[model samples]
Target: MHYNLRHYRAEAERHSHADFHQIIISDVGKLELEVEGRAGEVCGRRMAFVEAGRSHAFRAEGLNRFLVLDVNIDLAHKTGIEALWQSRGRASAYLELQNGAQGSLLGLLDRRWFRSDASEFTGDGMPFTNAIGDPGLVDQIRLILGHSRQAVGTEKKTGSDIPTRLVRVMDWAETRLTEDIAISDMARIAAQSESTLFAAFQRYLGTSPMRWLTAKRLQMAWFLLQDCQIQLSIGDLANAVGFSDQSAFSRAFSRQFGRTPITVRRDARKLLGAKL
Candidate 1:
């Protein structure tokens, strides 16, 4: 993972990343982001997500501070954070973190990522190491993942049975991410009643079935966007991801990833070049 502290005074030219996922957390002042063709503003303590190869630009209203993290795509996948990554595509343009969690995260970045004497720092009893190798990077990734999951209301599984049942439901939903999935569908797949399924999801995932399905579809769309081999128009991609209208798909995409489909495609083209 790569980290940077940005203090912005002017607008940045439109740019894209080829192989890194970006997390931009607003710390001070106001910042406006233009991704694809859409624009959104970040104020206060909020974070924005930009998938690899997505085109985006930024401008500041005044002095703006940002904590940015750029994580390798493959390492992200290897961290058992597929669920977080899948649902991340559905995050709003800027997500507000709880005060305690926000402070803790910022403090961690300050003490560990920015400071040279980070060797003295310990997080949850794990010794801090220079962010130079995969081990240290992966540890930092887990820290971010843990905090992000908590920030997004992802709950830890309390019971083994709940996870087993939820896994069955998730597996069924994953295969049909592009289909219109209902609570009944999940219930049937899990061999449980609708209420039982709902309870299981609530206990293990802390969300409803349809909401999870929507997240799954968004994740599928994100996955498709990253595949240079798949030549698809935004409308086609929307339809492929079970969205009936392009506008709705665009809205959902922007809400999830803080970037537009056009932006994603543009960045993908730049990253893949001839392959795309």
Candidate 2:
């Protein structure tokens, strides 16, 4: 959890973090970033993700302050950082932050990351304003850019219409939230190979298929946790959502929703109390 305000000197600074992922958000002025031979920049409206083990260099002129987050490579796996690394190049250049939520997201990040309370790129494939220091802030960023499509390379689909086969797959997954389903299972439902299914998901959903499945399962668990009409023990709720281990379920839920199962249940009780 390395969140800091960084400054690069006028000279080019080249380095690589082979053990962790680093997110660079532009603050005062423009900063050039070259990661793994690919180049991008961060202005007031841009940012960059430097994945682990990639050779990266940075250069900036005049006054500049950047907010950078260093994430463990393991945590980067299912949490939208992987696709971002894959989608960086050529046509997907300049990942720009979204319009309205940019201010709020940056404000929240500044409060949490910096001592004060404040944040793109050419590639709209990834949400640029994202700062994942807190679970609640991460969930907020999730809601803001959750609908945008992404691509693995450059052919990202920006259309609103969901791919028909993907829709079928989503609907099918919704019904089997409690089951032990995998990416192969989803590919089978889509009537395609796992690679093709993975590509389609990356192109249309901005995430991998298995990550989406985990998200869906956690979403169902959230719904159950917040429902006042139904009372399920935490372990029961976890089991109902395909989590054999309650501790793992709680960790995933907190990561996704910024709250624990017990907390969510308590909130529901508070809601009921208010209603009564």
- Return the top candidate by TM-score: 2
Residues 1-276, candidate 2, lDDT per residue (tens digit)?
456666667788787768877766665557877776766677644556666787888788887766666776766665655554455423343455442223324433543334433222222123233444555544433332332222233222233777878866765565455667788888987899999999998988899988887887786666556655444578866876678899999999999999998998898889989989
lDDT of each candidate versus the true structure: 0.60, 0.62
Residue 170 CA error for candidate 1 (Å)? 38
> What 10-residue stretch in candidate 1 is worst by lDDT?
119-128
**Root-mean-square deviation (CA) per prediction:** 18.1, 16.6
TM-score of 1: 0.44
- Number of clashes recorded per candidate: 2, 15
